[model samples]
Target chain A: MAPKSKEKPKAPTPQPPPAIEDLFASLHRNIDKSDYEKAVKDADQVLSIAPNDEDAIRCKVVALIKDDKIDDALSVIQSSRNLPIDLGFQKAYCLYRQNKLEEASACLRGRERDPETLLLEAQILYRQGNAAACADVYQKLQKSGIETAEVNLVASLVSAGKSSQVQKALEAW
Target chain B: FPPAFQSIPRNPIVLDLAYNCITFPDIENRMKKTRKGLISRFWG
Candidate 1:
Protein backbone atom coordinates (compact mmCIF):
# COMPACT_ATOMS: atom_id res chain seq x y z
CA MET A 1 0.00 0.00 0.00
CA ALA A 2 1.28 3.45 -1.00
CA PRO A 3 1.81 5.90 1.81
CA LYS A 4 -0.64 8.82 1.81
CA SER A 5 0.98 12.09 0.62
CA LYS A 6 0.87 14.94 3.12
CA GLU A 7 -0.71 18.14 1.78
CA LYS A 8 1.21 21.40 2.21
CA PRO A 9 -0.59 24.40 3.65
CA LYS A 10 -0.86 27.49 1.44
CA ALA A 11 0.69 30.74 2.62
CA PRO A 12 -1.68 33.54 3.53
CA THR A 13 -1.96 36.44 1.06
CA PRO A 14 -0.90 39.87 2.23
CA GLN A 15 -3.71 42.38 2.62
CA PRO A 16 -3.38 45.98 1.40
CA PRO A 17 -3.93 48.97 3.67
CA PRO A 18 -6.86 50.73 2.13
CA ALA A 19 -6.21 53.73 4.36
CA ILE A 20 -2.69 54.41 3.15
CA GLU A 21 -3.51 54.39 -0.55
CA ASP A 22 -6.74 56.22 0.09
CA LEU A 23 -4.91 58.91 2.01
CA PHE A 24 -2.24 59.22 -0.66
CA ALA A 25 -4.79 59.39 -3.41
CA SER A 26 -6.77 61.97 -1.48
CA LEU A 27 -3.64 64.06 -1.11
CA HIS A 28 -3.08 64.02 -4.84
CA ARG A 29 -6.69 64.89 -5.52
CA ASN A 30 -6.57 67.76 -3.05
CA ILE A 31 -3.40 69.09 -4.63
CA ASP A 32 -4.94 68.94 -8.08
CA LYS A 33 -8.00 70.73 -6.80
CA SER A 34 -5.87 73.19 -4.79
CA ASP A 35 -7.56 72.12 -1.56
CA TYR A 36 -4.50 72.76 0.58
CA GLU A 37 -6.01 71.96 3.98
CA LYS A 38 -7.18 68.55 2.91
CA ALA A 39 -3.87 67.87 1.24
CA VAL A 40 -1.99 68.77 4.41
CA LYS A 41 -4.18 66.53 6.53
CA ASP A 42 -3.67 63.58 4.22
CA ALA A 43 0.06 64.25 3.94
CA ASP A 44 0.33 64.48 7.69
CA GLN A 45 -1.34 61.10 8.07
CA VAL A 46 1.14 59.57 5.65
CA LEU A 47 4.05 61.24 7.41
CA SER A 48 2.97 59.80 10.76
CA ILE A 49 3.38 56.31 9.34
CA ALA A 50 6.57 57.00 7.37
CA PRO A 51 8.41 59.94 8.86
CA ASN A 52 11.10 59.93 6.19
CA ASP A 53 8.69 59.87 3.31
CA GLU A 54 9.90 62.57 0.94
CA ASP A 55 6.75 62.67 -1.13
CA ALA A 56 4.57 63.15 1.93
CA ILE A 57 6.81 65.90 3.21
CA ARG A 58 6.74 67.59 -0.18
CA CYS A 59 2.98 67.42 -0.29
CA LYS A 60 2.86 68.98 3.15
CA VAL A 61 5.10 71.81 2.02
CA VAL A 62 3.02 72.35 -1.07
CA ALA A 63 -0.06 72.51 1.08
CA LEU A 64 1.58 75.08 3.28
CA ILE A 65 2.57 77.21 0.33
CA LYS A 66 -0.89 77.04 -1.18
CA ASP A 67 -2.34 78.12 2.13
CA ASP A 68 0.02 81.12 2.15
CA LYS A 69 1.84 79.73 5.19
CA ILE A 70 5.27 80.59 3.85
CA ASP A 71 7.05 80.77 7.20
CA ASP A 72 5.69 77.45 8.33
CA ALA A 73 6.65 75.91 5.01
CA LEU A 74 10.19 77.27 5.21
CA SER A 75 10.52 76.11 8.79
CA VAL A 76 9.49 72.64 7.78
CA ILE A 77 12.14 72.54 5.06
CA GLN A 78 14.81 74.09 7.26
CA SER A 79 14.13 71.52 9.99
CA SER A 80 14.84 68.78 7.48
CA ARG A 81 18.59 69.29 7.17
CA ASN A 82 19.49 66.28 5.06
CA LEU A 83 16.94 66.91 2.34
CA PRO A 84 17.54 65.83 -1.26
CA ILE A 85 18.18 68.21 -4.15
CA ASP A 86 14.54 68.50 -5.22
CA LEU A 87 13.55 69.32 -1.65
CA GLY A 88 16.39 71.81 -1.50
CA PHE A 89 14.93 73.50 -4.54
CA GLN A 90 11.58 73.58 -2.76
CA LYS A 91 13.15 75.19 0.30
CA ALA A 92 14.71 77.82 -1.90
CA TYR A 93 11.28 78.38 -3.38
CA CYS A 94 9.84 78.97 0.08
CA LEU A 95 12.50 81.62 0.59
CA TYR A 96 11.57 83.19 -2.71
CA ARG A 97 7.92 83.30 -1.68
CA GLN A 98 8.82 85.12 1.52
CA ASN A 99 10.71 87.74 -0.57
CA LYS A 100 14.08 87.00 1.00
CA LEU A 101 15.83 87.64 -2.27
CA GLU A 102 19.36 87.41 -0.93
CA GLU A 103 18.78 84.21 1.03
CA ALA A 104 16.81 82.72 -1.83
CA SER A 105 19.59 83.72 -4.18
CA ALA A 106 22.15 82.18 -1.86
CA CYS A 107 20.30 78.87 -1.74
CA LEU A 108 20.55 78.53 -5.49
CA ARG A 109 24.10 79.87 -5.58
CA GLY A 110 25.29 77.22 -3.13
CA ARG A 111 23.97 74.47 -5.36
CA GLU A 112 25.13 73.31 -8.76
CA ARG A 113 23.71 75.25 -11.71
CA ASP A 114 20.93 72.98 -12.80
CA PRO A 115 17.85 74.02 -14.76
CA GLU A 116 15.69 74.06 -11.68
CA THR A 117 18.04 76.05 -9.45
CA LEU A 118 18.78 78.56 -12.18
CA LEU A 119 15.05 78.99 -12.65
CA LEU A 120 14.77 79.66 -8.93
CA GLU A 121 17.39 82.40 -9.07
CA ALA A 122 15.69 83.97 -12.03
CA GLN A 123 12.40 83.86 -10.18
CA ILE A 124 13.88 85.69 -7.21
CA LEU A 125 15.18 88.38 -9.47
CA TYR A 126 11.85 88.69 -11.20
CA ARG A 127 9.99 88.99 -7.93
CA GLN A 128 12.45 91.68 -6.86
CA GLY A 129 11.49 93.61 -9.99
CA ASN A 130 14.87 93.01 -11.61
CA ALA A 131 13.39 92.27 -14.99
CA ALA A 132 16.62 92.66 -16.93
CA ALA A 133 18.53 90.48 -14.49
CA CYS A 134 15.79 87.89 -14.53
CA ALA A 135 15.81 87.92 -18.32
CA ASP A 136 19.57 87.51 -18.32
CA VAL A 137 19.34 84.43 -16.12
CA TYR A 138 16.65 82.95 -18.32
CA GLN A 139 18.75 83.56 -21.41
CA LYS A 140 21.69 81.84 -19.81
CA LEU A 141 19.52 78.89 -18.78
CA GLN A 142 18.09 78.65 -22.25
CA LYS A 143 21.57 78.74 -23.76
CA SER A 144 22.59 75.93 -21.45
CA GLY A 145 19.64 73.85 -22.76
CA ILE A 146 18.33 73.51 -19.22
CA GLU A 147 14.99 75.08 -19.96
CA THR A 148 12.08 73.38 -18.22
CA ALA A 149 8.42 74.27 -18.05
CA GLU A 150 9.22 76.28 -14.93
CA VAL A 151 11.91 78.31 -16.64
CA ASN A 152 9.73 79.00 -19.64
CA LEU A 153 6.77 79.94 -17.49
CA VAL A 154 8.78 82.37 -15.38
CA ALA A 155 10.17 83.95 -18.48
CA SER A 156 6.65 84.48 -19.71
CA LEU A 157 5.41 85.87 -16.40
CA VAL A 158 8.35 88.20 -16.15
CA SER A 159 7.51 89.53 -19.54
CA ALA A 160 3.87 89.84 -18.61
CA GLY A 161 4.50 91.75 -15.36
CA LYS A 162 3.19 88.86 -13.28
CA SER A 163 6.40 87.82 -11.61
CA SER A 164 4.67 86.38 -8.56
CA GLN A 165 3.12 83.81 -10.83
CA VAL A 166 6.44 81.98 -10.79
CA GLN A 167 5.70 80.59 -7.33
CA LYS A 168 2.39 79.14 -8.45
CA ALA A 169 3.93 77.60 -11.54
CA LEU A 170 6.83 76.14 -9.58
CA GLU A 171 4.46 74.62 -7.07
CA ALA A 172 2.61 72.95 -9.90
CA TRP A 173 5.89 71.64 -11.29
CA PHE B 1 12.34 96.65 -13.45
CA PRO B 2 15.59 98.53 -13.04
CA PRO B 3 18.85 97.41 -11.46
CA ALA B 4 18.74 100.05 -8.73
CA PHE B 5 15.46 98.64 -7.38
CA GLN B 6 17.12 95.26 -7.13
CA SER B 7 18.95 96.56 -4.06
CA ILE B 8 17.79 94.68 -0.99
CA PRO B 9 15.77 96.58 1.58
CA ARG B 10 16.97 96.95 5.20
CA ASN B 11 13.57 96.55 6.83
CA PRO B 12 13.43 93.48 9.06
CA ILE B 13 9.85 92.81 8.07
CA VAL B 14 10.73 93.00 4.40
CA LEU B 15 13.82 90.88 4.88
CA ASP B 16 12.07 88.27 7.00
CA LEU B 17 9.04 88.11 4.78
CA ALA B 18 11.21 87.76 1.73
CA TYR B 19 13.14 84.89 3.25
CA ASN B 20 10.69 83.36 5.73
CA CYS B 21 6.95 83.84 5.34
CA ILE B 22 4.40 83.12 2.61
CA THR B 23 2.21 86.20 2.30
CA PHE B 24 2.49 89.66 3.86
CA PRO B 25 0.56 92.85 3.26
CA ASP B 26 3.74 94.90 3.45
CA ILE B 27 5.57 92.77 0.91
CA GLU B 28 2.69 93.00 -1.50
CA ASN B 29 2.52 96.78 -1.03
CA ARG B 30 6.28 97.03 -1.53
CA MET B 31 6.08 94.87 -4.62
CA LYS B 32 3.29 97.03 -6.00
CA LYS B 33 5.29 100.21 -5.40
CA THR B 34 8.39 98.71 -6.93
CA ARG B 35 6.50 97.43 -9.95
CA LYS B 36 4.79 100.75 -10.45
CA GLY B 37 8.04 102.64 -10.04
CA LEU B 38 9.79 100.30 -12.43
CA ILE B 39 7.04 100.68 -14.98
CA SER B 40 7.02 104.44 -14.80
CA ARG B 41 10.80 104.82 -14.84
CA PHE B 42 11.61 102.28 -17.49
CA TRP B 43 8.63 101.11 -19.51
CA GLY B 44 7.05 104.56 -19.72
Candidate 2:
Protein backbone atom coordinates (compact mmCIF):
# COMPACT_ATOMS: atom_id res chain seq x y z
CA MET A 1 0.00 0.00 0.00
CA ALA A 2 1.24 3.48 -0.79
CA PRO A 3 2.36 5.35 2.21
CA LYS A 4 -0.55 7.17 3.77
CA SER A 5 -0.96 10.60 2.19
CA LYS A 6 0.36 13.30 4.41
CA GLU A 7 -2.47 14.86 6.35
CA LYS A 8 -3.06 18.55 5.84
CA PRO A 9 -3.13 20.60 9.01
CA LYS A 10 -6.43 22.32 9.60
CA ALA A 11 -6.49 26.06 9.21
CA PRO A 12 -7.19 28.06 12.36
CA THR A 13 -10.69 29.42 12.58
CA PRO A 14 -10.90 33.16 12.13
CA GLN A 15 -12.68 35.09 14.88
CA PRO A 16 -14.82 38.10 14.24
CA PRO A 17 -13.14 41.45 14.66
CA PRO A 18 -13.61 43.07 18.06
CA ALA A 19 -16.59 45.36 18.32
CA ILE A 20 -14.48 48.05 19.84
CA GLU A 21 -16.67 51.08 19.26
CA ASP A 22 -19.80 49.37 20.51
CA LEU A 23 -18.05 48.01 23.56
CA PHE A 24 -16.58 51.41 24.34
CA ALA A 25 -19.94 53.08 24.02
CA SER A 26 -21.50 50.45 26.23
CA LEU A 27 -18.74 50.97 28.77
CA HIS A 28 -19.38 54.68 28.73
CA ARG A 29 -23.07 54.14 29.24
CA ASN A 30 -22.40 51.90 32.21
CA ILE A 31 -19.95 54.39 33.65
CA ASP A 32 -22.43 57.23 33.22
CA LYS A 33 -24.98 55.24 35.15
CA SER A 34 -22.38 54.18 37.72
CA ASP A 35 -23.02 50.58 36.74
CA TYR A 36 -19.46 49.63 37.48
CA GLU A 37 -20.09 45.91 37.03
CA LYS A 38 -21.35 46.40 33.49
CA ALA A 39 -18.59 48.91 32.86
CA VAL A 40 -15.99 46.37 33.96
CA LYS A 41 -17.61 43.66 31.89
CA ASP A 42 -17.59 45.84 28.81
CA ALA A 43 -14.04 46.95 29.41
CA ASP A 44 -12.96 43.36 29.88
CA GLN A 45 -14.67 42.49 26.62
CA VAL A 46 -12.69 45.18 24.84
CA LEU A 47 -9.50 44.02 26.50
CA SER A 48 -10.17 40.45 25.50
CA ILE A 49 -10.28 41.55 21.88
CA ALA A 50 -7.34 43.96 22.04
CA PRO A 51 -5.30 43.65 25.19
CA ASN A 52 -3.49 46.88 24.50
CA ASP A 53 -6.58 49.02 24.19
CA GLU A 54 -5.67 51.95 26.39
CA ASP A 55 -9.18 53.32 26.51
CA ALA A 56 -10.68 50.04 27.65
CA ILE A 57 -7.97 49.56 30.23
CA ARG A 58 -8.49 53.07 31.45
CA CYS A 59 -12.19 52.44 31.59
CA LYS A 60 -11.61 49.33 33.65
CA VAL A 61 -9.38 51.32 35.95
CA VAL A 62 -12.00 54.03 36.35
CA ALA A 63 -14.72 51.47 37.00
CA LEU A 64 -12.54 49.87 39.62
CA ILE A 65 -11.95 53.23 41.24
CA LYS A 66 -15.64 54.09 41.16
CA ASP A 67 -16.42 50.74 42.66
CA ASP A 68 -13.95 51.41 45.50
CA LYS A 69 -11.51 48.75 44.38
CA ILE A 70 -8.50 50.97 44.88
CA ASP A 71 -5.80 48.32 44.97
CA ASP A 72 -7.16 46.55 41.96
CA ALA A 73 -7.39 49.83 40.08
CA LEU A 74 -3.78 50.64 40.84
CA SER A 75 -2.64 47.19 39.80
CA VAL A 76 -4.49 47.52 36.51
CA ILE A 77 -2.97 50.93 35.94
CA GLN A 78 0.50 49.61 36.70
CA SER A 79 0.02 46.68 34.34
CA SER A 80 -1.52 48.55 31.42
CA ARG A 81 0.70 48.90 28.35
CA ASN A 82 1.24 52.24 26.62
CA LEU A 83 -0.26 53.74 29.74
CA PRO A 84 -2.59 56.60 29.05
CA ILE A 85 -2.15 59.98 30.72
CA ASP A 86 -5.44 59.46 32.56
CA LEU A 87 -4.06 56.30 34.19
CA GLY A 88 -1.47 58.37 36.02
CA PHE A 89 -4.22 60.58 37.36
CA GLN A 90 -6.20 57.49 38.26
CA LYS A 91 -3.26 56.08 40.17
CA ALA A 92 -2.84 59.36 42.00
CA TYR A 93 -6.51 59.17 42.93
CA CYS A 94 -6.06 55.70 44.34
CA LEU A 95 -3.11 56.92 46.35
CA TYR A 96 -5.19 59.78 47.62
CA ARG A 97 -7.91 57.40 48.68
CA GLN A 98 -5.29 55.39 50.52
CA ASN A 99 -4.30 58.61 52.36
CA LYS A 100 -0.88 58.58 50.80
CA LEU A 101 -1.00 62.27 50.04
CA GLU A 102 2.70 62.72 49.44
CA GLU A 103 2.90 59.74 47.12
CA ALA A 104 -0.15 60.90 45.26
CA SER A 105 1.39 64.32 44.85
CA ALA A 106 4.57 62.76 43.56
CA CYS A 107 2.56 60.79 41.04
CA LEU A 108 0.70 63.90 39.94
CA ARG A 109 3.93 65.87 39.78
CA GLY A 110 5.44 63.35 37.41
CA ARG A 111 2.72 63.87 34.83
CA GLU A 112 2.71 66.72 32.33
CA ARG A 113 0.01 69.41 32.37
CA ASP A 114 -2.92 67.08 32.42
CA PRO A 115 -5.84 69.18 33.63
CA GLU A 116 -7.07 66.22 35.64
CA THR A 117 -3.67 65.74 37.24
CA LEU A 118 -3.48 69.41 38.13
CA LEU A 119 -6.87 69.19 39.81
CA LEU A 120 -5.77 66.11 41.75
CA GLU A 121 -2.54 67.86 42.66
CA ALA A 122 -4.55 70.59 44.25
CA GLN A 123 -6.68 68.07 46.06
CA ILE A 124 -3.65 66.21 47.28
CA LEU A 125 -2.04 69.40 48.51
CA TYR A 126 -5.14 70.20 50.51
CA ARG A 127 -5.13 66.73 51.99
CA GLN A 128 -1.50 67.23 52.89
CA GLY A 129 -2.45 70.29 54.97
CA ASN A 130 -1.27 72.94 52.57
CA ALA A 131 -4.38 74.76 51.43
CA ALA A 132 -2.27 77.70 50.31
CA ALA A 133 -0.34 75.47 47.95
CA CYS A 134 -3.57 73.84 46.87
CA ALA A 135 -5.05 77.23 46.12
CA ASP A 136 -1.94 78.11 44.16
CA VAL A 137 -2.34 75.01 42.04
CA TYR A 138 -5.98 75.86 41.46
CA GLN A 139 -5.13 79.40 40.39
CA LYS A 140 -2.48 78.13 38.04
CA LEU A 141 -4.91 75.67 36.55
CA GLN A 142 -7.44 78.45 36.01
CA LYS A 143 -4.78 80.64 34.41
CA SER A 144 -4.04 77.83 32.00
CA GLY A 145 -7.54 78.25 30.49
CA ILE A 146 -8.92 74.84 31.34
CA GLU A 147 -12.15 74.81 33.28
CA THR A 148 -14.17 71.87 34.59
CA ALA A 149 -16.17 70.81 37.60
CA GLU A 150 -13.22 68.90 39.03
CA VAL A 151 -11.10 72.01 38.75
CA ASN A 152 -13.77 73.95 40.55
CA LEU A 153 -14.12 71.12 43.02
CA VAL A 154 -10.42 71.24 43.82
CA ALA A 155 -10.63 74.99 44.09
CA SER A 156 -13.38 74.44 46.65
CA LEU A 157 -11.21 72.02 48.56
CA VAL A 158 -8.43 74.55 48.61
CA SER A 159 -10.76 76.98 50.33
CA ALA A 160 -12.62 74.59 52.55
CA GLY A 161 -12.74 75.58 56.28
CA LYS A 162 -11.25 79.00 55.56
CA SER A 163 -13.87 81.68 55.26
CA SER A 164 -11.63 84.24 53.56
CA GLN A 165 -10.35 81.73 51.05
CA VAL A 166 -13.85 80.43 50.53
CA GLN A 167 -15.08 83.94 49.86
CA LYS A 168 -12.24 84.53 47.42
CA ALA A 169 -12.82 81.25 45.64
CA LEU A 170 -16.50 81.95 45.46
CA GLU A 171 -15.81 85.32 43.96
CA ALA A 172 -13.41 83.83 41.48
CA TRP A 173 -15.90 81.20 40.51
CA PHE B 1 -1.89 71.19 27.54
CA PRO B 2 0.56 68.98 25.70
CA PRO B 3 1.39 69.30 22.00
CA ALA B 4 -1.56 66.95 21.62
CA PHE B 5 -4.12 69.25 23.24
CA GLN B 6 -2.53 72.31 21.64
CA SER B 7 -2.95 71.03 18.11
CA ILE B 8 -6.62 70.14 18.49
CA PRO B 9 -9.09 72.97 18.35
CA ARG B 10 -11.82 72.93 21.00
CA ASN B 11 -14.60 72.24 18.52
CA PRO B 12 -12.73 69.40 16.89
CA ILE B 13 -11.27 67.66 19.91
CA VAL B 14 -11.56 63.88 19.83
CA LEU B 15 -13.82 61.80 22.04
CA ASP B 16 -11.10 60.30 24.23
CA LEU B 17 -9.80 63.57 25.66
CA ALA B 18 -13.34 64.74 26.12
CA TYR B 19 -14.03 61.52 27.95
CA ASN B 20 -11.03 62.11 30.18
CA CYS B 21 -12.27 65.61 30.74
CA ILE B 22 -15.48 64.13 32.10
CA THR B 23 -13.75 61.47 34.21
CA PHE B 24 -12.59 63.72 37.02
CA PRO B 25 -16.00 65.20 37.70
CA ASP B 26 -17.56 61.81 37.34
CA ILE B 27 -15.12 60.70 40.02
CA GLU B 28 -16.42 63.30 42.44
CA ASN B 29 -19.96 62.11 41.89
CA ARG B 30 -18.92 58.50 42.29
CA MET B 31 -17.10 59.29 45.50
CA LYS B 32 -20.12 61.06 46.83
CA LYS B 33 -22.20 57.99 46.10
CA THR B 34 -19.69 55.45 47.30
CA ARG B 35 -18.04 57.17 50.23
CA LYS B 36 -20.93 59.49 51.08
CA GLY B 37 -20.12 61.20 54.37
CA LEU B 38 -16.34 61.01 54.06
CA ILE B 39 -16.51 63.14 50.94
CA SER B 40 -17.82 65.93 53.13
CA ARG B 41 -14.46 66.79 54.68
CA PHE B 42 -12.88 67.11 51.25
CA TRP B 43 -15.73 69.00 49.66
CA GLY B 44 -16.55 71.18 52.64
Best by TM-score: 2
Candidate 1 CAPRI grade: incorrect
> For model 2, how big is the iRMS in angstroms?
14.1
Model 1 C-alpha lDDT per residue in residues A46-112, reported as the tens digit of each score: 7788777777777787678779887888887877677562556667887777778787787777688
Q: What is the lDDT of residue A108 in candidate 2?
A: 75
Which regions in candidate 1 have their CA more than 4 angstroms from the true location? A1-18, A83-86, A127-131, A142-173, B1-44
Model 2 Cα lDDT, one tens digit per residue, A1-173: 99999865655665676457666666767878999988989889988988886667777887887787889888897887355445667777788888898887787775786666776776666667676676666666665565454344444453554435555554575
> Which window of 10 residues has the lowest lDDT sum in candidate 2 chain A?
A149-158
Query: Which ranges of candidate 2 are over 4 A from the true structure?
Result: A1-22, A81-86, A142-169, B1-44
* Per-model CA lDDT versus the true structure: 0.63, 0.64
List, for all models, the DockQ compared with the true complex.
0.02, 0.03
